[model samples]
Target: MASNETPRQWLKRTAGRGARWTRLSVIAGTLSTLVLLVQAWCIATIAQRMVIDGADFSSLTLPLMLLPPAFIVRGLLIRGRTICSARGGIEIRQSVRRELLERIAVLGPFWARRQHSATLSNRVWDQVDALQGFYADYRPQMLLCGIIPLIILVAVAPLSWAAALILIATGPLIPMNMAMVGIGAKKRQEDQFQEMGRMSRHFLDTLQGLSTLKLFGISKHQAQEVHTASESFRRRTMRVLRLAFLSSTVLEFFASVSIALLALYLGFVYLGQFHFGMYDHGINLFIGLFILILAPEFYQPLRDLGVHYHAKAEAEAAAEDLMPILNRRVFERDTDQPAWQPEASIALTLEGLSARYAGRASPALDNVTFELHANEMLAVIGPSGAGKSTLLNVLMGFMHPEAGGVSIKEGTRPPRALTDIRPDDWQRQIAWVGQSTVIVSGTLADNLRLANDAASDDALLDALEQAALKHWFDALPDGLDTRLGEGGRAVSGGQARRIALARAFLREARLVLLDEPTASLDQASERLVMDALARLSSGRTVVLLTHRMELLALADRVLMMDQGRVRALDTLDALRAPQGPLARPAATDIPERRDV
Candidate 1:
């Protein structure tokens, strides 16, 4: 995936890594070629015996009996070729997708946010599928096209050097013309894939935003935009198809003309106008028929390779998109890194911490610093654009700091830098409740078990009770087994948030991070969620971000932030004293929580 690598070179390198599969395909194709040579010889010999020898039907019985089984064996070999090619395709495609998924896992949500999910899904699924024919059909045929023609030439040379030279001379022309058409065909295919990706992204976005469009009464206008995009994609696809068809036409033109030349020479010699290209017998039906039969077979593999050339072009297009993602460098915890386990509670410290996003002019968190004590609730109250969420993200091991650092300590052990801690180990020790929850396509119990897979039914019920969802749970037709998320019954936003809270309650972690846990909720739902938060935070160190005055009562201290810098970190009483920015009077006027 180096920048200097051409698309063809990149594909060769990737497909080379899965050489075992490619080898299987090549071997199958070679066996098929050998069988085809035998089949052609058998058919030609039978025709020569009957036409030139004028043999009786009784004399032809032996060859007639053998020809059927020869064809049967050839058919079986062709079947095997197909099976081997398909298997190779499946194995290679699986390898690419597995590697892609692993790389994406290391990059995490930061990468997902920057890309359209539909685009990624298409590349992983449909684009990978496109590579199947390249490995299965095109690659094997590439070798067959080279080897099979030489084989035909060698077999024919013993009969007539004239026909042998014709095949040899014309063989190069097919691949030469193929190379000429392939360059433009490949470029067109790549452009078509890009257009497809854009269409998918646009369509998915429009679908997700349809409700908003309806609200603004511009749904019809948006529909026209979608239509235009779809039409553009259709036109691009047709262009690719035309190029593919043009390449086949050029290959067939060369192959047909070569066969015709061989036929013309054989025809003249057969009719006695020409007396050359024979081994003393001048020209007989046997040799002439054999050489003529071999002519088409000589060019058959090349024609097939040309036909499946689009598979190669399609796979190259997919690889152009896939290679960058596969080669992307992302921070991943070493598997050999020591796993850290804390005793009861943990304390955290941020010293002059700073983080900047790509293409941003300034750091999202600049010289920000704070401390959280064990078994204490610390609330961060910050205006919009004050880096509150960035701080939480760093604590959750989702973002790496660009400058300064964070450290965590438990019991008597010295504090360790956050970078030194493996994310999986550290994340296992804490539970988080974000503003919006991800309700996956599964049952309620399945989602809850993601937090603590070992939790029993009783444990799950207790967690639901703690999240103030017991009443809703009782009304459920299927209770915890009810399917939620997409393609299932939908849950209210408040219910979804509470389901997330239930997951947190099941974790029983000593550290909890809350990001406006009750934002945008109805007053009653907010009260219920706050009650759940109160129970979930008991005896746990907590970091909460909120503009809700009611939740500030739960915080022992408050960190007031503005413009990516901490203005003050002091007790709630101190922050509420006289002229403080977060005083009761000013806190009441602050808007509902918003992400920084």
Candidate 2:
């Protein structure tokens, strides 16, 4: 993953993680080649004694008896290679998946929002899975290509140097031709990977928004998009296969031509038209037959390598997408570093903080400064693109400030910079609930456990009751144990949001960050969530981002932001003045601070 490092190089570096099993596969393959030489020698001796020497059947007993066991041992060795290779593939995949998940965790939810969930899932599963065949078959085969062919050449050189020379000459053709074909194959494979991710993301989006599409009469348009993507992927796949077939053809031609040329030379030597291949004398039936048999073995490794060359291409293409994520430099935070401690309630301060997206023209949070006293509620109101979410992201520890900083203090402790704290320690004290809640494929209890893994059944029930979901829970056929979420039973959007609120309750975090928690809920759902939120927020610090001006009344102060800059910060009563930015909100939506 160094600058200018190729994908193939990255794959080799990754291979080191499971080198033990790969080494076992290599050992078995090498031993199998040696056993193959023994078997070939036995075949040649038997043919020579029977055909040329006119020996009786009884004299051939030993060679014939040794043949079956050698075949069995060779089969066992091949099986051992397969077993070792599979284990190596599993280890490599496990290592890669763990790294990917860890990277996502470190990047945090704010960064993850910028990427497509389906695309990330493809990287986690499909892209990583594509490497299995390479580690399991192509890697060991590539290594044996180097060692096995050399062994075959050595065995043949003593009997027929001309055949060995043919092997030496023709061996490069298969790999050289394969390399040429692989150049184009790799480009196709990379394109395919990209198309696959795009298609997956597209499909997931279409499915998730199917109701919206139907409402707008645009479902047909999305269907056509899917068709277009599917056709493109199919054509790309066919092109890769065509290259694969061409590579195989090239390998077969070179190997066949080399073996045929050796056969002709052995025929001439037998017919006494040639006299120059043997070490001490003219070629005999045993020597010629052994050399011919060993000639094919010399090219076998190269042919096997040709067949699996596509796997190498596939793995490299997968690595092309994966290496950047793995090699991305992350700030190393010290576990033992001193960090600010907020006790009893929360006190927050931001100073001249600035942050920007990768390709943006301006900072998302530009020199924004703010303060909130212990147990205070701050409502951040902004038009879209106004640093409201960015401020919450920084406070929630999902992102760090690019310039300036944030600090926290409680009681008599001195204010300390957020960067001074371990990220884990900072996150432990904050509970975040975004607009949408993710319900994974699991049981109702399993989904709830994601919040607090050790929460007892009674604790979970209590949390559900606290979220106003006690009736919902009781109605389920199996109660807490009932299967829910996808692949089980779907819950309404309200239930999902409440489940998130329950997590916040279970966490008992001192700071509560809500990013438009009631944005898309129905009137009843919104009321239930607000009631739960008020309970969760009471006596704890709260930073709420919303456009709901009615909800602003619940806050001690309302901060207005525009174009990443704070426009105003004041009490809701003050903002409601005719000269202030706020327009008075209707009381029917939400009435009192405590009732919110």
Candidate 3:
């Protein structure tokens, strides 16, 4: 979480971690300040010597000798400040990025589902870019602005109190004016960022749904939506630009006005019309001339502070959006439990399970009791909206049940809820093949390695052969090394599914969960997939969720689901009897299978 401090306070907090660098920067800034003051004093002394005493050039050589060292010190200080600032900026950027990545990992699937991909992408890149100002430009400029003016006042006061007083009075006005102008600018900048995020999200959604729209002949309508989103984004950005320009104009006006007022006062003293500090003598002409030259340098840092304030405002807006993700509630349940290591065969049970979505009237799964012993296959059959997929999510520990629990039993200990089991252990023991497979952009070997990083070339080939994809791989120019396009777009749908199944086979998990794995395949592809599934489930626990009744012959038992509850569970033959609740409907497309 970001500190809710004022800008100055927040700047202080950010710099506090880099105290050593900050101290070095401050020292350099101080040296730079002293050099500037020395130069001013030397010029003033030289002018006074010439005008008041009518001195020659030879007599003024000693006073002019002080210029080189002051310039050299000033240059060195500037270089030091630059180095310190760069180091600080890099450290801060790395720290923030690390924290953001950790938060994302902690939030897990819940956060990923809720967040727009483009918005998250922008936060990871653009928002972090925006934060560079707090470390690089803002902190250093703030130090200089806060410290240099005081140094100038001390240097100039003894020489000409009138000039010092005028500078001191007007110096505070620059930042104050900026603050007033920026209040509205910050709000507008935030709005612009939000609008940009909205546009990004809409574009991503449109791209994802473009295929669907094309299938339905409505892609042209989606294009119109894209155009509208783009224009809205453009208008919001113009508003942000308008506010930025107005802020700059206001800061410039105040800076110019302050400098002009100081100049007016200096001119009066130059004409011997103003006096201060009990001297009946009018202001010294040489000192008045030097003060005029030095006044702008004193105010220069303040003007820079004003400009960087806009950058800070933009950064804060980004940070505000990021804060909720960093502080989200999703990861609060992870405990300090030991890692799970099962000693015997894996068995699973769901007892009186019921779950509802966050804002739903009724449960998606109610009293859904079932069990699968080791090396057994269970087929779950249901209509389109009968919660088959939801059951898989709960059994896989991706979702928690509202009224019951999923448990794993072993030889010794009492049955433990799936929630209590370590996630790494559960994931290591289970492999999933869903209707939509993930085909990352990589070579065949590279994709296989995702399931088992230590799998040898021979092992990969064996898995591919089992999934009926070995001939496809062999025909490719590079064979195992052939590169697949993004999401395996280069491959046919059946080939992609085979690759996914090959990945699952390579994992060799104790349990396999298949969700409509043959959904869109042709007859030959479906037979190949079912054969592959039979081979993979040879010695593992298998749960198959499908609508095809012909596949039930492969299962040891079949569970029928209706609404959110399990209607019946029995052997396939028993469930197919005339009196069974799962008796085939008149419109069912499935053909009964004969014994092999």
Candidate 4:
């Protein structure tokens, strides 16, 4: 993982893998450097003839003409380098984001529940964007810093070996200074990114719960907490920025000192005081002019590297958060494996099933055993926190069990472990309706078609009718095309529940799971939902969790659960028998039944 990798090593590894994109950028930068060399030679030659040799404008014509084109070409190369770098950075960002999204989808709800929406958003957006400079600017400039200075040294060697020696000797000092100042930069930037994430999460949570805070008259207190968090984040961000600024200042200082030393040495040679390293006709106008002009260009790439170094630090920090997610182990599946297609009838068996969550004291499902026959409807009855929802999550492949396993048995075929089933296939054969409806901001038809994107308008209408929502849509001006939910028309609690039911009805799934689907509905709404549910459950295996006695009549059998264990599984009449343990009023009294 990049978390354990050194910042330099991680940067090199990721940048190396993207050589196809970055190669063009490096080539462009090198060509630009070569063009600058030609420009410097042209300027030096022209100056020498005009000043020392007493040449006229006619003698300077060719060099003057060559000068403009060199500058133009150099400018064009710089633009090309910028373009190539941006494209490479964008390509890398897209690839990484795609991989992260695919991993999140495979990890399912269990992993998603563990992460805050704000934290994940920060990772996918801000953290990913931070890598742009590393791929585009830092990687290419790193190469140029090494090669360009060597090119300048070689160009100076023929004129005066003393100057070449000075250039070579002083070049290492800038990087040495930059390295010393940049100590712990990666860790600091990582901490900065973390603080930003925390700030984002805190703000989002506070904003979402604004109404609740107002109700409790503690909105001011929460606001103060948010302000405090923002201040902390601001201070941390400044620290990282300060470190970057200090690194840049140190690099510039060394580069300036190196150039000054070269200038002083050239001045002594020109004065005829130091003449040891010069060749014949040494330290004349042309040689002195050329070497002096090229001095800053020699240190230019290093200065640029110092500037791009912050990008490396930022990307390293992002990678520390990014790599662990990419390296996470999710549900294993063979690439060549086909989707699992169930028959018209589907039966499920659970053998000594047990599942637990991290850092939890007790198992969510404890040695639970049950068989669901094909086309049978079973109602699960249990108090709050009795593992009803956990069972559904396990059945849907969202959560993995710690011990034992679930398998599907087909007619005359061997039972296959649920683990053997591909996620896409398993999900294709099942539909779910939770207690609270998910009303995304979209058209009524848009929301309905989410269950089956390929479903026709007629199919959607049929599902809506089955869920007892046909009248509501029919009365709307746009009918099934009516816009609803957030940012659209608001829907009541019962209408939203029916929409969720309609989504399930629209699916071609052979199995259906409903978790407290009618929990908060009034009698009228419950009757409507139950009517739609009864029709929807026909020819499908259904597992429902409801407190409504009327809904239990639809179940072929009832499963009683307490403390993660199944206490009984029997026909409703059998369970309701006077002598039956599940017949107790405390166990059987649903809200509606108790009021009755």
Candidate 5:
């Protein structure tokens, strides 16, 4: 079932499962508090026996002798609580990170484009790091702090109601002061997170585009911009630190004052200068010492909470940043039904298609129309920015048309809009080879198996032969098993393109879409690619987008697009003849194949 809960709610629900550990930790904490109270009681009892009864050191030592067991119990509980808190911290961090990744996967390319890579990285690492405080310290300490104070008050009330009243009244002041000072600190921490995300994104952008900057001789200027962003982030961090210190200082001041006031009240009782109704016994050295030792313990959690409050604020700020991308709606229509089957042959039709990019004034493709028949090879030739790539994207279902839609004709179905078909289904029937070949980090066989996981070694060899990459594979020390570096950077550009084509060949899809299949190849390699393409297209539907005349000549029909519309669609000879749109070829034109 789909969950309607927001991210924060989801986090709460997931964290609540750790209630078992929380309960265990609280039990240990309470046991530790009891041990402390026993130690205090033992001290008071021993002192009363020593002073009031005038007893010798060896005569009355039972209460003092019980201290060892209490100390041992306290030590074990502290260690166990620490372990539980650490486990909870790890669980929350991992759970939140996994949830974020799953949401991103569901959102796909639509959500990815809206977010900066570095910003997302920061949220996953830096923002999630802040949540350690929430799980590790704040949560556990809050429980312990509340429980310990109540236990203290209950134990002391019967013995000295006036002392218990004073302790309870001043205890709340620590947290009250924290809340008052922490509000502004939390706000500042949130702003600091935003600035850090912006800085990270700017740095990533600069690094990714460094080659372009160097080519244009503007690298230094871009470097200066990075420096400026870094400086801005540093300043913001400093502002956050200043607020943090101020909040800590304020919390400390109030906690110290409260502790001092409690001590002074106990001192008056110790000197027999004051007395509470029905509790006339003066406070002794033992009681005074107990109160002094417990003073720091009572205030320590509040101080820690002040610090963790900033961490929670930073985490929430990051969550707010990532929430929109996770919540974004991508193709709103349902696609739960099984896919339709394509017939033996496929035919594509686009009628009155128009598309304008988001936040753009002019349409990239306007009123575009075309028809590609079954088992026919069509070549779409155009200049840069002529909407040739846009056409391919729309056909592949990567982008939706604003006005009319693409349709596929199979048999008695008449014609069904591409949007009506599932993208995964349509993609399975098609083999796409583009200019910038993507080579994942793996062995040659691993990359080849991406198209058809069930492909045998023999089938992979056949694909390599078809792509003219068999010789290259043979030269490798491990043949198809040789590892490729990241993005195939270890191989030449031409080799990477051949490997990509080999992948497409392995798929053996009925519809083959080649976008500049021979762009990176030499003359000999180009001929080999063209021959392989001709052989592959013999019994399949092929759509080739290129400017090369030799490849265009193989097309059953050539489409010449200008400005977002198909200006001509006919035989290559007819289009190249006098009075055709591309009648005159420039001298510098190399007739290279294009890729979308």
Candidate 6:
């Protein structure tokens, strides 16, 4: 997936990675084509013996008997080719989709949130599916177009070189027409995909914000907008389909013309207009009929290729969208198992740390330095867009800083750069609860065990109890077996955050990262969340990002930040002093509901 590689090249390269499956299909298709040649020769021989030599039907029994089985064998080979190619497509699609998911995961939560869910879904599912048609239908057909037609030419050459010459001349017309049609096909497919993505993104946005639209009395307007977008997408899709159909029609016309010209040449030889096409310097019924019979078969592969040509165009368009994400620089990891052993007493230091997102003017964390000892609860306070949570992302191992760095030191161990720590082992030590909770579709017990999937149901129930989700769990009809998340049951905001807390408890990690976990909860929900947070942080090191002042009660020290730079880092009482940087103001008081 080089930056300058064309989409078509990318597609072929990706498909080539699974060449074993393509070879299986190509081999079967080649066999089928060879059988087709035999079938044609048998038919021509039978007609010559019966009609030209005045042989009786009884003498033709052997060839007649062979016809049915030849037809059956050819059909079976064709079926096998189709099945092999289809299965190959399935495996390739699965592999690509799995790779896309892994890439998404490694891109980290910040990258994940930047993508709109619907656009991401379309890229992973619909776009990946587009690649299937290329492997399943187009690849084999494309190869057969070259192999089968040449086989036809070689078979017919001995009987009538003139027919073979005609085939060679006329055959290029179909492919030429395909080339002209293809010039527009790729653009149309690209347009269609773009429109589809635009429509899907808008539709999903409207759906997610439907309540807001209605509250603002603009739902109808948005409905109209969605309708407009859908209509535009429909038109683009239709245009793409029309381009595909136009290519097929042109190809069929050329193939039919090629076959007809070959027939006319054979007809001329039969009427004694010419005798030079035959090897014997005299035309016979067998030679004439054989060439005519195989005429259309010569162009058959070309015709099939034309029909499936849209698949290639679609795949190329999909590759254009897929390559960027696939080629993204994912978080690095150790190939071998890392032998990192952090001591029980962990200390972390950030020195002149500067960081920014992929495309941003200002750094998200700018020369910001900090230190934390084991079991210390560091509360980071900042206003909106203050980069408070960005620090948490860094601590959570989601991303790296552009300048400066973080290092960790364990008791009796040399300091190691945080980036040197293997991501797997580094992540295993930290449990994170973000503002938005992703509860995948699963049973409640399954959702709670996300960090430690092997956790037993009883252990999950206990963790839920510790997180104060026990009452919510008890209210469910199926208890631990109750379905949650998408398409099952939805949890309230507080419940979702508490569910994350339960996961943290089950994780048994030494370090915890909480990103405004109780940002928008009501009094009771906030209290429950705070109580659970308190219990979860009892022994674990916690980095808490908060905007609420009341939540600062749990912080052993407060780190105030503004515009990606640290403003102050001191005890609350010290920061509240009149001469201190964060001198007390009524505005500094966090909204109520800090205590459990």
Shift in Å, residue 519, candidate 4: 2.8
RMSD of 4: 2.9
**Steric clashes per prediction:** 0, 0, 0, 0, 0, 1
Q: In model 2, what lDDT does residue 441 have?
A: 85
Better of 4 and 6 by lDDT: 4
lDDT of 6 by residue, 1-596 (tens): 47788887777777866678788888988888788767776898898898779888888887788888889998998889888899889988998999899989888767887888888999999999999999899887887787888888888787777788889989888878778877888889988888888999999999999999999999999999999999998888888888888788888888888888877887877787876666865667877777777788888888888888889889999989998988887667566756776767577899999889877898888999889877888898866667876787788788788889889877778888888878878888889887789998999888987889899888898899999988888789888888997788889999999999999999988888887888888999999999998999888788888867677888888988878899899988898888886675764854322211
Point out the higher-scoring one by lDDT: 1 or 2: 2
TM-scores for all candidates? 0.94, 0.93, 0.85, 0.94, 0.82, 0.95
**Model 2 regions more than 4 Å off:** 56-58, 215-218, 335-343, 583-596
Q: Looking at candidate 6, what is the lDDT of residue 97?
A: 94
Flag regions of model 3 displaced more than 4 Å: 1-31, 38-98, 211-221, 277-286, 331-334, 411-414, 487-489, 586-596
CA-lDDT, candidates in order: 0.84, 0.85, 0.77, 0.85, 0.76, 0.84
Query: Deviation in angstroms for 221 in model 3?
Result: 4.8
Q: Model 4: which ten-residue window has the lowest total lDDT?
A: 587-596
Give me the runs in candidate 5 sitting further than 4 Å from their true place.
1-80, 110-116, 128-130, 139-148, 205-225, 277-295, 339-345, 409-417, 487-489, 535-540, 577-579, 584-596
Ranking by TM-score: 6, 1, 4, 2, 3, 5
Q: What are the root-mean-square deviations of the candidates from the true structure over C-alphas?
A: 2.2, 3.4, 4.6, 2.9, 4.3, 2.6
- Mind giving the per-residue lDDT tens digits that candidate 2 earns over 1-596? 48678888888988999899999999999999899988988999999999999999999999999999999999999999999999999999999999999998888877787889998999999999999989988998899989998898878877777878877887898888888888788889999899899889889999999999999999999899999988988988888888888888888999999899889988987788888766786688888888877788788888988998998999999998987777777667777797544677868888899987778888999998888877888988766677777787778777777798988887787877788888877787888788889888888888888878998988888889889999888789888778876668889989999999988888777888888888778899988998898888888898988766656767888888878999889998787787766654442133112101
lDDT, model 4, position 35: 94
Q: Which ten contiguous residues of candidate 6 have the minimum total lDDT?
A: 587-596
